[model samples]
Target: MIEVQGLTKQYRSVRAVDDLSFEVKPGKVTGFLGPNGAGKSTTMRMIVGLDEPTAGSALIHGTPYSKLKNPLRTIGCLLDAKAVHPNRSAAAHLKWMAQSNGIATSRVKEVLELVGLSDVAKKKAGGFSLGMGQRLGLASALLGDPEILILDEPVNGLDPEGIRWVRSLVRALAAEGRSVLISSHLLSEMALTADHLVVIGRGKLIADQPTYEFVKEHSASNVLVRTDFVPEFSQALENENVEFTSTHDEEGREQLLIRDQTTDYVGNLAYSVGVPLTELTLKRASLEDAFMDLTSDSVQYHAEALPGEDSDAS
Candidate 1:
């Protein structure tokens, strides 16, 4: 298990991570989510003792990373896939890491097969594709068969098959009672893989909860309805105190967006008002939508488009 308390990091005059506190428990995949400059990488660096924290502490199994005996065997990390030497073969890289940490050389081949990199183990890492490099990095991290795995963008350049493989691997590792903490910008992927989430914005914690609970609390639920009688529908909805917005369809029929109600309630209201409903459905917001809503203001870059502007105008 990993426990972070009052973690803070500052570079020059700017704060990168601010008073962050959270815990990653065993037997679960905890996703670390944030925008581009939200200090997620900084926090991960601090956890592994790659970067020093200005205040607070990050402990792995109740010991600081620098003070841990056999640190690599306790906490394995893939902070940067490109941190390896370009001239070395994948096997040579893992062999040296195993030697440095007194791990068995046979573990290198084991991790290679585990990550599906055995076929390319003899080839120089410089010639490998980004996806292949990621696999090699993962192989190195698993060399010690550590109890904790901290990966940053592990699936960034992987193809669909590779992505699925990583997801399954993470899940399988956690099922063995290992703690897995993954940092990624892919909300859809994280939603599928992570059991819990820790979201931060501008170096501050915005949410820390289960994946389902986070979505439920931050996303808005709405009802969608389609009808031909636009005037009657509006009047009925207004009378029932249902706030709605209308948009015309290709067939000139009206589609309403109803707020503060469920689809069943809207359907019953339409039935009571003698209006035939073509469609009545509930629209539950997705994790991507929730992420955008939560971090919209904290985004470092914003795209600008004027009203009625063409795509090429900007």
Candidate 2:
């Protein structure tokens, strides 16, 4: 397990990370999330001893990273896919890292094949595409067979197939009792890959919970109902003190967006009031929705609305 306790970083007048605390447990994939400039990269740097924290500490299995004799064997991280030497072959890069960590040279071939880079192991890293570079970085992370993995935007340039492979690989590692902490802007994939989430805003911890619970709590889930007798249903809903919004569909059919109520409650209420319903469906919020809603205040950059677009949405 990896533990971050009261971790903090200061750059002149700005505080990049502010006393952040969390744990990445074994046998689970924990997603690290935040908006741009939310100190995600800074925090990860402090965790791996890349940057000195102004205060607090990050520990891997009870030992700080700086104190570890073989840090790579305890924690594997891919913070930057392009941090490799441009002139070196893919296999050569892995070999250097393996030698530095006293890892077996045979393991380089194994990891190259594992990340599907054996075919291009002799290619210079400078000529590799973005996706291939990412694969090489991943190979480096796995070279030590570390118990913990920290990957930042691992799927940044991957195609659909490569993205799916990453998802499966991380899950398989976690299944084998490894601790994985991944950071990505791909909310849909994060929702599928992460068992837990650590969301931060303005360098402070905003949420630390299971993926499902985080989405369910941060985003609104409503039951949308369409009915011919919209007037009666609206009145019934108001009488029950249930919260809802009213809108018209594309077909001009009136619908009620009932909140804090389940489909059964809406369906039963409609039946009791003799209202005929055309449609009743539950619309749960996705991980992207939850992330946007929760991080609205913490977003560092905001785009202006396009012409004829709603400013509120922008």
lDDT of 1 by residue, 1-314 (tens): 99999999999999999999999999999999998899999999999999999999999999999998777799899999998899999999999999988899999989999999889889999998999989988987788999999999999889999999999999999999999999988889999999999999888888999989888888878888888786898999888777889976678776888876888888888899899988888988778877877877777766787886653323
TM-score (all chains, Cα) for each model? 0.94, 0.96
The candidate scoring highest on lDDT is 2
Worst 10 residues of 2 by lDDT: 305-314
Worst 10 residues of 1 by lDDT: 305-314
Which residue segments of model 2 deviate by more than 4 Å?
307-310
Candidate 2 lDDT over 1-314, as tens digits, reads: 99999999999999999999999999999999999999999998888999999999999999889898777888899999999899999999999899999899999999999999999999999999999999999999999999999999999899999999999999999999999999999999999999999999989999999999999998888999988788889999999999999987888877889986899999999999899899999998899989998998998899998997877664
TM-score: model 1 vs. ground truth: 0.94
- Candidate 1 at 228: error in angstroms? 1.1
Best by TM-score: 2
RMSD for each of the candidates: 2.6, 1.4
